[model samples]
Target: MKRVLNLVLQSAKPRTVGSLIFSRNKQKMAVSPSLNSLSKVPKSSSPKPQIFNLLTTTPKTHFKFTPIFKQSTLSLFTAGHANQKPTIKHHSNSSTRCLFTGIVEEMGEVKQLGVADHGGFDLKIHANTVLDGVKLGDSIAVNGACMTVTDFDKRLNEFTIGLSPETLRTTALVELEPGWKVNLERALRSVDRVGGHFMQGHVDGTGEIVGMEMEGDGLWVKIKTEKSLLQFIVPKGSIAIDGTSLTVLNVFDDESCFNIMLVGYTQKHVVLPLKKVGQKVNLEVDVLGKYVERLLGAYKTS
Candidate 1:
């Protein structure tokens, strides 16, 4: 029996012995050169050790390496590339756009025949449209200010309207020269779809039309309004200057005036800066102001 055992052990190769021992009880078997040779073993200097350490021992939070066996692919079914730019669609008329007719083109002449203590003045405006298809008490925008057509001359194409000294102080029409341009839009009616707004034809206050000049291919007009109206005016905020929707720009707290910046496009197409210095532009605080005020009032009470 002893002789037979010795022969059997001697016949077995070192690699074969290691394999047999490992297959029987791998946990108890130590890795050795005999076992290494049997399995076409990897080279000792292989990059696998470093790669294993990077994936296992190093904190997952510190290193972001992904394993080849665990890798996944992402498929996109969308038509365009992820980084492609999107196309933009242009509309015909933006809300900021204002349209006016030809009748009251130039600034009308203001003749203050009389004045009252309550800031009132008897004024005369010689305008073609004011006299055309217009009757007494009809609303007309004079220099961007809304005024009732108190009287008109069909033959001469001229008209007359009354303005309080308050109106004079609040609008650019106060300093109107006979040939200056004035913007005109009729008052909205219930049958009308309220194209602009419910204009009272009453000027709340007047703002100073200042800093008028050519900017690029268009004219740039700036106006200064009282600080009381500043809170209601936001950048690109809507404000009615002489019944025209003008945008608000550059609002300041300490200053009494809020600056209204107008682009050249508005100047060329709209009657924004046609008046001179010390000219009063009838200003109507945005209708949104009343709603905002109501909301704030409700909150305070609540």
Candidate 2:
């Protein structure tokens, strides 16, 4: 009975010790917080862990996030960089028929006259027209040919414009001198009313002023043209002789020169009657020459 009592006491002591170890382990686990429980804890109670997570995770979310407004803004910036502005062209506003004004500075004196080697003469004009109202740089149309005022004479209405050798052979002005009368008109201005045909003040060549005869109070003047202008010359066709508009009286096939029969009114109002035989007159072929040239040029290109 004594041996049985000692063995039972030893076994009961081991059982009590095991039960105490198990109860202590369970109490520690209950006191400790899990991941979900930590999230529910007050921020003030766990500031250190909360701050660490915010610093690390905030940067990752910012890097990964993309807003719709930011994508649209980026697309607009890229389009602007790739696009280019369009270019515009400007044109000039001036007509081809623009005529410049020319003030006569002097009444040139004729030095010598006759046919020239190139079919015109060297006309020597000594006049004061250059010194009175004209400058050395002024432009003048001598018999409708644009020429620079080269010399001046202040005492006398005199200026000099070189007549080409071809002009002497064709026009009666080749025989003009100090006492001869010259018909003069200023250049047409933009504001000035256009009274006659467009005059370029460019004389193609000269023509002979054949005759000035009075018939029944009217004057009839005749001019001889070169073979080149014959086709363009027609009766009643518009012609500018010495910058004055004149009509063709009769265009004869037999003769190279055509006649301009002027009425008595034109003979009195204008300088038609002043014209005499053997006198040279400046001639402009026609304005239609430009239109014909343009049409032919376009046809060739096509």
TM-score winner: 1
Model 1 lDDT on a 0 to 1 scale:
0.57
Q: How large is the C-alpha RMSD of every model relative to the true structure? A: 18.4, 15.6
Q: How do all models score by TM-score?
A: 0.52, 0.51
After superposition, candidate 1 runs with Cα above 4 Å error: 1-120, 165-173, 177-180, 190-198, 254-271, 277-279, 298-302
Q: lDDT of each model, Cα atoms only? A: 0.57, 0.57
Compared with the true structure, what per-residue lDDT tens digits does model 2 show for residues 109-223?
4554444455643444554333445666455555555555545555655555556655555555655765555545444557876656666666666777777777787677777
Per-residue C-alpha lDDT of model 1 across residues 1-302, encoded as one tens digit per residue: 55664576577743355334322233553433343356555443543534446545655486566766563444243345556777688754321233332222344444334553445565565555445567677766665556666567777666767775667665556565545555655544345455344444455677776667665664555667776666666776666776566566666666556666556555554455655666667777665686888899999999
- Residue 115 of model 2 has an lDDT of 48
Q: Give the TM-score of candidate 2.
A: 0.51
